[model samples]
Target: MEMQKMSNGSHHEYETLDKGIQPEEESFLPEKTDTGKKIQFNDFEGKTSFGMSAFNLSNAIMGSGILGLSYAMSNTGIVLFLILLTAIALLSSYSVHLLLRSAGVVGIRAYEQLGLRAFGQPGKILAGVIITLHNIGAMSSYLFIVKYELPLVIQAFLGQTSSSGDWFMNGNYLIVIVSVTTILPLALMKHLGYLGYTSGFSLTCMVFFLSSVIYKRFNIPCPLEAFGNFSNNATIPEDTCTAKFFTINQETAYTIPILAFAFVCHPEVLPIYTELYNPTKRRMQGIANVSILGMFVMYLLTAIFGYLTFYANTEAELLHTYSKVDPLDTLILCVRVAVLVAVTLTVPVVLFPIRRALLQLLFPEKAFSWIRHVAIAVCLLFCVNLLVILVPNIRDIFGIIGATTAPCLIFILPGLFYIRIVPIEQEPMSSRPKIQAACFTSMGFLFMTMSLTFIGMDWMSGEKRSGGGH
Candidate 1:
């Protein structure tokens, strides 16, 4: 009896083993059949340690969503926002559990492959399209940050205003420069494991941003009125400083979708799991748990402090709200630079899943090719840069995509995949887990419907708002 490793890149048809795999590889090994033969498949040989994997996943979770969370908290109030945040974090963890379980049952690591396992070619196509669209939206949003914020950071550093008319201050030219120099190189890496260090650096930048937010809350005085002229200040109002426990308003409809959008890291989950060293369902799940929990705490603190500082004047984007107070403040300028660095590094991490999904859909049988990989990365960045540059208002496009895709990735697909992929004999329809999965799927549809309805109402009313800080 011996264990065999096949180098073919095909997604289907595992190489069945006549005997057991080595103990180190046992975590990902398939269960032995009645014939006592083990089943194994070709996967990217994982090299990332547990910590780096967690960092990569955490960076994926932390996006422009953090910026909008403060605004969401402003509408929902402190207590209610905490409830929604806690519930969504727990549900996101559960969804990852479902994905891990489904993958383990069939020894399929790629998300699109899991889709193919469940339904057919159509499932694979649907999964691929959703992943592509979702990540495209994500990449566009990150570049949008570069397009808008990088200019401001430069202006602050140079002590020049936007009216300078200098090419260095032009956002369009700056985004292109950053993409060619920074983002494109990182995106060209051969494996997701290689990005672990960049991901760690990105998260560190975010921690600095979060720390700055907390610091500003204490330093910035209350009743902070009259921004255009800093010399004029109003007296403090006791009522304005007080925190609200619960509240409801027309803007309340946007809160859930915003929170949901913040947690849409599902596309990256399986891929990170694929590259994790000594990977197991539990260890990957631990990675997810640690990453989610860390982001949850960071999100919670950022929202609470940001909203507390601005109170009624909080804008849809927390950083923008800070800008209205004092645009040239040194610490705030540094915070902007930190945020720019974080999101810039994150573009590559987000780009990996999109590139992988495209490969799965377009070239499932092909082995790793540098020509194809580099071409895809270059093409994707070019398209996203075009989208960011050409579109006058990306927030509206971002709104529509977030409303449709975020819930699907977060709630709908995982629930549907688990129910479809898991064997009926192993866990029947009437079983507790199956029933829970069904309910989870139904909840996704409900969330999608509610988000669209509210966003539609806002459109009809002609009220402009940020799409969860996209």
Candidate 2:
């Protein structure tokens, strides 16, 4: 037997969780002859029907990027941001639909699993490499945000001295603390579901934080009550609120772009479809609705809060805005703590998938062996910690990763998967026009290239010229 090469790259492991599901009786499938024909739609055993589907899409949507959404959207305008966010989120939900449809045809549990089954090891390797680069970078940025944001939170609530002034001290202990906070939770959890309650709690804290900021605005001298939950729309007059939803809503150009990127890409959503009880178009839509709407609300609230609170400040950034609001009370302190801990808790949840993927490639037959799993898991946690400590700033890293990964994973890859895999007769969208497929694929290719370029620039700027090269 030929040995399967791993060449998994930096991705530790992206596991295929035992969904423990019962097959829906209603699903369509082809039955084969007694000889060697084929049985189609053979029901998958042990799928996690709606377990992962219920993953607070709001939580997935509201994650690390959310902490910065306000700032990212700062210049984009409040109405613009909200309107764009809403439109973008809907697009993501649709992307998920297309991607899932492709997966169903391919008969894969995990999305990356498709890359392996369809394209072969090299394809898997390439996809893994791209995903790993993007994921690790993205995860690292989250760590960075926690490091800086948490301390300010700590000082504000506890009355301890703190400042963004000391660059050295900030980076040093900040990473250590973040690594400890993020890594510990990850190491302790045995299953993804184990962290479900914590994720829920974390999400609640986020909503609470938004509420606090909104309430605080009322207490401010000039409360921007008018800005509450108001999303923008280009169709309406820029300044008028009554006639339309919000005049300054998102631009049509970026709507597709943003939607292409924003709502989906949680990594866990794919499995949800596989595990669905009935796996009906109706059930799938329900799962998607819960998943997408949940996320949309979270993003919208956070974006709006940030806009109302920091729209005028020089920074207009989320964390910076929080600092300005400077709510040092016990309640506020607790709120910051909740946000810190919630974000920190999410690290392990994200890492688990990468670990699973690693196992499939490196040890195909013995994929689930505990020894290999533990060994790799420990090593990855250690490495992430090392990187967290080594890197100086989280925001810079965060920006780089978001710019690189967000486009493809969010807008581009899903589209590409649908375009390449699903036949028109199977899942036709003839009304939308095929140009969109071309556009999304091209965009993904371009963004993936951009991510590589950004990393290449980082390498060049960080390294010195070798004597022989000249």
Candidate 3:
């Protein structure tokens, strides 16, 4: 029996495989019966349900990025931000459709395999690299949340003041403790399917976070009495509760990339699809739709309520804004804990794609080993913890990763893969699919160019502010 490697480095053997099967007819099939009836593949045996798959994907899509949406809304205003967000959601859903269609047509379940089929080794390597970087950035963001919020949660629980220099209260120490005790164990799991439970819990935490934001929106007063206590010397805006309907400035461009970063679950999509029971293009697409739509509603509500709550004073990270208002408030403390738990749980989900990408690139021939898995998980968490401790600005990290790899994964690669994988004869020159692919590719380029330009502008403006202060 000949063996072929699956995306996760496991071998699958097929008896009497057909070598002459065309790409279009290579759909996944179960073993043939004595009468030659094609039976459906039940490899999973219905272990994973549709709800679990949707929850996993939803957890992947909603991460630390949700915390920044209010800040993005503040930059672009209510009208423009909602419009931009809706457009991005629709575009992201379409891109996923393109990717799944290409994979289904070729019967390739992994993103790297699709890349390998499209452009040989270079394509595979490119996909792996992008996945690694994007997911690393995501993991770092989750750890960043831990770094900043964990300390506050601990202090709230202990009723300790911020002025205390207790070593136990140090953010870095707390992060290390949490990583070793909680995140490391979760990250060491062998299969992505096992994470469905944790993913569901993680998503629940985010939902609580959304609910808390909405509740606080009505509870908090304008010109925030909380901010007065935190910043005694700073001037407070008189009309902080009123939302901005429309606005554009140097900072507005940064919001586009931030929003782009929020919708990136492309790397995790195929892995979930492969493990799905009775996986088909239509079924997987349904999973994608449910996941994206759920996240879209959550993101919108979070952004709108967050922005409305603090309006002019909305900080890049919503938790920070809440901290300044009343760190000791019971509801605020609960929300902080929820956000912290949510991000902690999310770190493992994000790490799966990164580990898989590394295996694909560096250890393609190697079988899945627990030793290697634990070591990689440990090493990655260690490095991300260091980055979280050292990197003071989350926005800068978001900008750089969102500007570069996010676009490539979300837009460019998918469109290019579809164009290359679908036969020219099947999608003729004037075909709508071909035309849409071209338009999608063009949009990816435009997003990449704009993201870079805005990042540069943000950097320059920061330099100017530093120079002026000096």
Candidate 4:
């Protein structure tokens, strides 16, 4: 069998394996060969079960983005948001198909390596930088959730107020504690597959949160007497509870970008594919579909219930909107705790790809080392904690990063990689696949341009609006 070169430092091993050796279920086993020499076969990469892989990918796909979705629904109204969201979800799955097809053609698992194969060194660098930036933003956003929400959770449990000077109530201190105690150890794991259990738990927590949102819709009366610090004397219009089927306004531009960013699990997709047991393009694509479909249901339910609960008054962060109706409510407190736990567990899953991308960029030829792995995890967590602690209300920064990188990951890079790496001889320029890939790439450019333009308008017009976090 002819072997394609791998750019992520596994070339030698794969090349050697190509010389008539096949990997199996065991980690390593020596095989008797015709040449009277034992051949060592390693199955280091394919240990993650199908179910666990789906859990991890599902955890990656669902993030703090879920919290912002209700706000997106509020802006676009019921009919429009559903249409846009379903479109984005389908497009996201198609994007994964493009990526898997590209990876299959080149026999490369790493996204950066696929880039290198597609466009050489520059391609590799672009993939590496985007992965780094996008994951960092994700990690920071997750930690920001911990920083802001964890304290509220603790406060609620302890029956204390935010004004309390206790260390647990301090978001900065609580975030560091969670990072060091919970996040650090899991992040130190050698492989992405090992985090699968935690990812499963994280998904469960989010499910609890979604269930709570659905339940609360029936319990909490609309046209709330008081919203946060707003006066109870303020009268909300009676129509505030009415759902809008279709709407258009300045805020309408944010709906697509919000939904686009919500579906960004591209960085995690290739890594999970590499670790899947009995890995195949079809198998990985199935995992992606299952995960995406699961999240689609969760996202749709969360948005519909959350929007129905608040109607026009839904805040960008769904949890915060809940606080407006008695922050000390036991059910709401549990929901907050669930969200905190979910986001905390997801950080390590997001961090793995960033570290892998870094290792690929900085030490492509070097073998994996414990020292390097632990160090990368530590550094990433520390930097993210700093961003959460030191950077006050810097979500706009991450918002911009998400706007730029999310679409690239979701649409542009996959489409471009497919267009460039899939040989013209196999699929000619005028072929349907190539034409579709070209169109996919164009759509990404359009998404990025529109997202940035709206965001720029917000900044230029001095409107510090809250839509959703990417």
lDDT of each: 0.85, 0.54, 0.78, 0.84
In candidate 4, what residue range of length 10 has the lowest lDDT sum?
22-31
Candidate 2 per-residue C-alpha lDDT over 41-96 given as tens digits, one digit per residue, 9 for 90 to 100: 32343243464546533444555555555544544565666667766666666767
Candidates sorted by lDDT, descending order?
Answer: 1, 4, 3, 2
TM-scores, each model vs. reference = 0.92, 0.71, 0.87, 0.91
User: What digit string (tens of lDDT, one per residue) describes model 4 on residues 1-470?
Assistant: 23433445463234434533332222221234466543321225478999999999999999787998888888888999889988989999999999988876656678898889889999999999999999999888888888877777776777776558877688999889999999999999998999999999999998999999989999998667765333577665667779998988877787888888888999999889877777777789999999999999999999999999999889888888888788788888888888888988999999999999999899887777999999999998998898889989886788688888998899999999999977786788899999999999999999999988887888899896755665
Q: Pick the candidate with the highest lDDT.
A: 1
- TM-score, ranked from best to worst: 1, 4, 3, 2
Model 3 scores a C-alpha lDDT of: 0.78
Residue 420, model 3: lDDT of 89
2 against 4, candidate with superior lDDT? 4
lDDT of 4 at 433: 93
Return the TM-score for candidate 3, rounded to 2 decimals: 0.87
lDDT of 3 by residue, 417-467 (tens): 998887776676588987898899888889899977866876886641100
Please provide, for model 1 over 1-470, each residue's C-alpha lDDT reduced to its tens digit, 9 standing for 90 to 100.
23345556474545436435432243455445456755335555677899999999999999987988888888899999999999999999999999988887666788899889898999998898888888999999888889889888887888876547889888888889999999999999998988999999999999999999999999999767643323445445555767787878877777888887788899999989888876779999999999999999999999999989988778888888888888788999998899999999999999999999999999998888999999999999999998888897877777778778888898898999999987686788999999999999999999989888877887898987544743
